[model samples]
Target: MNNLDLQKLLDEMTLEEKIDQLLQLAPAFFEGANSAGQITGPLEGLDLAVENVRRTGSVLGVGGAEEAIHIQEAYLRHNRLNIPLLMMADVVHGYRTIFPVPLAMGSSWDVELVRQAAAIAAKEAAVAGIHVTFSPMADLTRDPRWGRVMESTGEDPWLNGQFARAFVRGYQGEGIANEPYKIAACIKHFAAYGAAEGGRDYNTVDMSEWMRREFYMPSYRAALEEGCEMVMTSFNTVDGIPATGNRRLMRELLRKEWGFDGVLISDWGAVKEMIAHGVAEDEKECALKAIEAGVDIEMMSSCYPHHLQELIASGAVDVQLVNEAVMRILQLKHKLGLFENPHRYADSVAEREILLNEQHLAAAHEAALKSSVLLKNERNVLPLAKDAKVALIGPFATSDDLLGPWSCMGKREEAVTLAAGMLGVADPNTVTAIGCGVEHIPDEELAAMVEAANSAEVVVLALGEDSEMSGEAGCRANIQLPDRQLELVKRVRALGKPLVAVLFNGRPLDLHGVLDEADAVLEAWYPGTRGGAAIAELLYGEANPSGRLTMSFPHSVGQVSVYYNAFNTGRPKDDPNAQVRYVSQYLDIPNEPMLPFGYGLSYSSFRYGEAALSSPLIRAEEKLLLTVTVTNVGERAGSETVQLYVRDIAGETVRPMRELKAFRKIMLEAGETKEIEFEINEPMLRYHHADLSYKSDPGKFEAMVGPNSKEVQALSFELV
Candidate 1:
């Protein structure tokens, strides 16, 4: 619909209808809604009649094309204005052919692969009649205690921003002007929801404006820049005010300043829950504040319908706020071409054809292969010989729960198991197995399992958090492997056999307990649908491991929030000539992360040549060319991600020790040397200053080019 038609429809809406349009609900609100995606029963109170639901502009947490059609037909049947209900869902990773969780995808360090995965998710979700997906969660987090880290693409703002843009472009493929399989992307939890105090879910966040802009807001900016059509308000407070009701954040900064006119949504029940947050006295005030703050849609609650009309009558609120919100909602609907055809995406034939199609499944398989990071490989025990007898032991050995949390559309039964994958590559008879469980087993049972591993030439010990133990509401104080799993590692170590530990988890786990025992460790974070096949291939040298860590794996839970790019403290962790007492060192453990960000190993070794610079000095306007030669030293073809890092030697404000500025992923054959060059420009050096201005500080700067953050060669340059 055009602007004229949208305005006419908005003008025609009654106060009650307008308020209802702002409300989003599940299928239970509709009379004949299916149970496929229903999170809860119909919410009680104000207006949930079938007619009210018909006018309710949007529905979420409902599954399938036929069900969406059922609900949309019901809504359109009773409508005088013929407005269709907008369908939305959290297609977080995949709709059917689930790829690895976003965290694992981030590990791949391949933006194009991430985009392709999102495109696949969009295609599958679009066929199911979903108009919007709340995905590419751009929350910058550090603490592993945040269970939702599985949803985020890890801790770096720069990396997250890159992934955020890729996801937006993939989901909104050439905009709404395109066909099915492309939908609007929603960059969620608007500001610093990940930096919740102590990393607890839904906890408060107290961030300084400088810290907020410097570290947390970049990914959101990247999303909006990529044309993300919606923004979801976070549950946490920014400064003292909850982001859902903070005008300065939602309106002044997001809408006016950043120029985002897209629809703004509240995380499920975030609006009314603001009362519990002590920011509002009641639901009325919560609704008033959220609407005034420019939240166009109240998801999963009755706040607006419960109080908007009364507030309008009592002169506590203006109806214009409601109209503007509704207009934004209508714009989304129009852009989606919903006005032209509400049932466009609801096609059962297309849904049958697209879900888990061969190409999508293959992409998922490749993604899983690249996402498995080789955390530790001692004595070169990895890249198992094709003829080697394999014993795959673990509770996950045959289980298909590889589909991690947030995989709503993916059926676990369809997931390929490790046992199945091993059988697919080689003879099933050559692969022995035992019950490898995350939880504890009886001593006798454990002994029997160990006996099975003893017969194989090499053992593949599958372990890590249960699927339910590492997602939303799945926070763990102890991120180490479970007690039984830890004990199993020790037992396997006593056998003095070559072993590989395949970890299926969401967050960066503290691997200290089991690290020393395992000969090789692969962080295969909840590697979705094709997880089994990918791991099997990596083991047999079919695919070389190339994925890197996006989030730093802490040496211990005590160091929960660890990352490569950290501010230089007043004192360093260890001064070679000084006593340890004065420095910011941890007495018990080293201050360094166990596995630093951008750290990964491939089967083939890579050697980085000292970086060569075009010039040591350069004007602000002119660019400096930084070049480095990366050679594959090992006797195999492989992929390497060459990272570019920078440090502000001196600046107007404090700076991180090293910041990732750019990276390039390239493939090389044995003994092949490739030259990689990156343009160093003024924009790359800019940051949010003490006064909130974004600009580059003219000063001496250092750049490093290498395989990862920790291992690099540096060169100095001047930006004058």
Candidate 2:
């Protein structure tokens, strides 16, 4: 529909109808609506009436195309305006062909691969009749204690921005209005939801504006600038006001400043939760504040439908506010071409043919293979010979819990198991045993596991958190592996057998015992449907492990928020010779994480030459080309991600000790060397000032190039 037609439709809508259009309901409501105008079938918990349910604008979490078609048909028959229901779901990583979690995908450091995985997800979701996906969560997180960290890419602003744009491009390819098998992408949790206090979910976030701009807001801006069609408000407060009702955050900053005219949605019931946040008095106040703050749609909340009409009548809310919000919703429906074809992209036959097809499975396999990081390889114990006898012990050995949380439409029973993958690759003599559950081990199970370990040439200990232990509400106070699994490790160690540990988890954990006890360690984080097959190939030397750590692995949960980009203190601990007690240092533990960002290992070793610069000085808009030679010194062919880090020596305010500016992932044959180059300019050194000005200071700058954040060679340059 054109602008005139949409405006006419909006003008024709009654005040009650306009208010109802801002509400989103589940499929149950539509299935329950009757000709007598009474809603049935277990929807008594909601405050919505039959008339409002029929004219509801959107549906949340519809299962498949068949259900979506049924809902749309039922909805249109009752809908006076004939506006089809907008279908949406949380398609975070993948739809049917589950790929690695976003955190693991960030470890791959391959943006093109991220784009491909999202495109595959979009195709599958579109066939399932989903019109919008709440995905590519752009929250920059530093604490692994937060279970939702699995949804974020990593802790870095620049890298998160890169992944954010890639997701938007993949989901709404070209544009959703012009494409068929694509869905509108909704970049979520608008403000800093990741910086929840104490790493607890939905906790308070208190950060200065400068800090917010410098670290947390870049990725959201990148997604919106990439033409994302929707934004979901976070459940946390911004500057003491809940983001759902904070006019400064939603209306002023997001709409006027950023020019995001797309739909702005409240995260499931966030608008109503404002009352729980102690800011609003009741449902009427909730409706007034959220509408004034520019929330175009309310998800799974009845505050708008319950009190919006009364608020407008009492002059608490202008009717024009409702009109504008309704217009945005109508424009989105028009953009999706829903008016012309109510059943857009809903085909049961196409859903079967396209969901989890061979090509998608292949892509998922590649994502899993690259996203699995080799954290430790003490000796050449990896690349196990196919003829060697192997014993796979622990709960994950035969379990198919590879699909992490929010795995939309993925079935765990259909996933490949580690035992099956190992049996397919290794010799017939390989044996498997379930030594313990995630947290408990029986005496008989322990004895059986030890017997199998003694008979094998090597033992592969599959251990990590359960799928239930991470994602949304999966926060934990202690992130260490279960004590029983650690005990299992000690028992296997007593057997004097070569041990390899394979971890399947969502967030980074304190790998104290496992890291030290195992001869080799692979951080295979929730590798999706084909994860077992991918791990099997990497174990048997069929493929090389190339992924790196995006978030730092803390040495202990006590050091919860440890990350690479930290500020330097006045009294430093840099000088090893200085024995001063006044320095900022920990008495019992080291300041560094056990494994830093960009830290990963390959079977083939890489050596970096000294970094060379074209010039020592650069001005604004001038480019300084820095080059380094990376050679595959070891005997195997592999891939390596060369990272470029920059440090601003002095600035308007203090800057991080080091910030990741850029990186390049390249494949190398044995004994082959390639020159890697990166351009440095003034823009790379800019940061938000105390007064909220974004610019760089003219001073000395240091550049470092290496495989990871910690181990690198540095060079100094001047920026004027």
Candidate 3:
């Protein structure tokens, strides 16, 4: 149906029908009994309420190909208007063939891999009859402490935008409106949810309009430009107004100013939670505020279905606003071809054929390998000889704990463990011992593992947070390895063997112990099902690790808000005496992060040469060419991520000390030299001024090129 047809349908619907269109019912798979034995509302069974809602108009959240077809049949049989139900699922990473989380994928700096991951996710999700996926969360999160940061691409807006476009193209392949199996991509958390106060999930976001426009809004815009069909509103309040009810953000800016024609869905229960935000007195008021703010769908929030009509009748919201929202929802269904053929995606044959296909597994393996960053390889202790008697220590050594959280579809039993993969590459006599669990293990077990390590030629200790330690509702009180696990590492190190620490985590860990003790450290951040295979490849010199740190690793949780791009304080903590005054520096630890963003090591070494600009001065319409030489100094072939960072130097408002402008991941043979160049246009140099205009100031600028934030070669340029 065209927009005119959707608008005509909306015009003819009753208030009840319009309200029904706005509500999204939960899937039967999510409604069931809790561990407490009490019936915990629909997280897993087909409820009578779901059937009633389907009978009224249309429903959402029907799962699997067969069940989706059944729901479509019911909607056709029972709905008075014969409107088709839309099925939505949270296909965050992969549907069944799991890939590394978004943050890990971002470290690869490979757009094609990112696209392929989303494409596989869409294929599996579509096979299950899902017409829409709420994914490609484009939030620019700098703080690793935020549990949801793992869900985002990374800290830089440009990189996030690149991945956002790739994901949108991948999910809505060849346009969602035309493809039978393609699902609509819902670019999420509309604005600045990543800047939540203190990195706490769902906390209020307080940022200047300048910051919001320059850094936060770019990813959303990129997703829209890439043809995303829907957007999910964030749960947190921005400038004291809940996103679900913020008319200035949702209506005035997003819709009117940016011309976003796609549907806007609220995050789960966000509309009802407006009462908790102290913005709405009741669900009725919440419905009114959200509808007026231009939210098209209320996900898992009963407020719209129960109270929208009452609010509309009271003149608290206009009928036109209701019609507009309903029209957008119907348009999305039309785009999904739901109105014409409701059962188009409900193919049982495709469902069984697509999930965990060989191609998907291969892609997952490639992603896992690319995301595994070789953080430290002191004296080249890694690439352990295939014939060496290696001792695989730590609980995760044999456990499938590398598969991180929000992995609803991944089977731990199917994942390859480090010990299994290592044994595949090493001699049959290779020793394996469980040194310590990520969380709990007896002291005697640790001692026995350490003794085995002493008998081996080399020891590989796999350490990291448990699978449940990061993701939604998995916030940590401390961002370090569990003290017991660290103690186990200390004991293993005392064995006097060549030690390699493989970290399996969802976020950057405080690796002070690994840095000081381990001979080699590989940051395998929750490498998916093929995690073990990837680790083995990196270990045996089959693949060179090239992934970089997308987020900073803080020295301590006390330095919680640390990032490469931070506003300089009037009293900078540059001097030891200034640190004594207790300005921004912690007394016990320095303000710097343990590992800066864009920091990663390889099996081989790299040296960054001096940076040069093509032109020292340029006009608004012109561009600057930045060139730098990167040489592979080590004896082995490897890849290096050459990063380009820029400082505003002077602006109308204070700016971050440095911002990532461009990055290129280059593969070089031993002793090879590569000249990496970046074209810096207005967008690269632009920042939000006090007036909220994204403009580049005509002043002196500093362009730096290097391996990471701290190590760089700088050159000054004048923008005239």
> What digit string (tens of lDDT, one per residue) describes model 2 on residues 33-110?
222111111234467788988888998778888888988998888888898889988898899899989999999999
User: Which model is ahead, 1 or 3, in terms of TM-score?
Assistant: 1
Relative to the unseen true structure, what is the C-alpha lDDT of residue 496 in candidate 1, on a scale of 0 to 100?
82
Give the range where candidate 3 is weakest over 10 consecutive residues by summed lDDT. 31-40
A best-first ranking of the candidates according to their lDDT comes to 2, 1, 3
All candidates: CA RMSD (Å) = 1.4, 2.6, 3.0
Clashing pairs in 1: 394-436, 395-436, 395-437
Question: RMSD (Cα, Å) of candidate 3?
Answer: 3.0
TM-score of 2: 0.98
Residue 503 CA displacement from its true place in model 2, Å: 0.3
Cα lDDT tens digits, model 1, 1-720, are 689988988888888889889988877777557864635233555455666677787888667888888888878888778888888888988998999999999999999999999999998888889999988799997999889999999888999999999999889987965755689999988999999988788889997999999999999999999999999999999879999999999999999999999999998888888888999998899999998999999988788988899999999999999999999999999899888998767788899999999999999999999999998889899988767888888767777889899996899988988788877887777888676567766788678768878888888898888888877778888888888778777887788889988888999988976677899998889999999999888977888999999999999989878888898787886557666698887889888989999999889999988789999987878999999999999999999999999999987889999999999999999999999999989999999888999999878999998888999899999988
In Å, residue 293's CA in model 2 sits off its true spot by: 0.8
Model 1 ranges off by over 4 Å: 36-47
Better of 1 and 3 by lDDT: 1
Clashes of each: 3, 0, 9
Clashing pairs in 3: 29-44, 30-43, 30-44, 31-42, 31-43, 31-44, 31-45, 32-44, 394-435
Question: If scored against the real structure, what TM-score would every candidate get?
Answer: 0.98, 0.98, 0.94
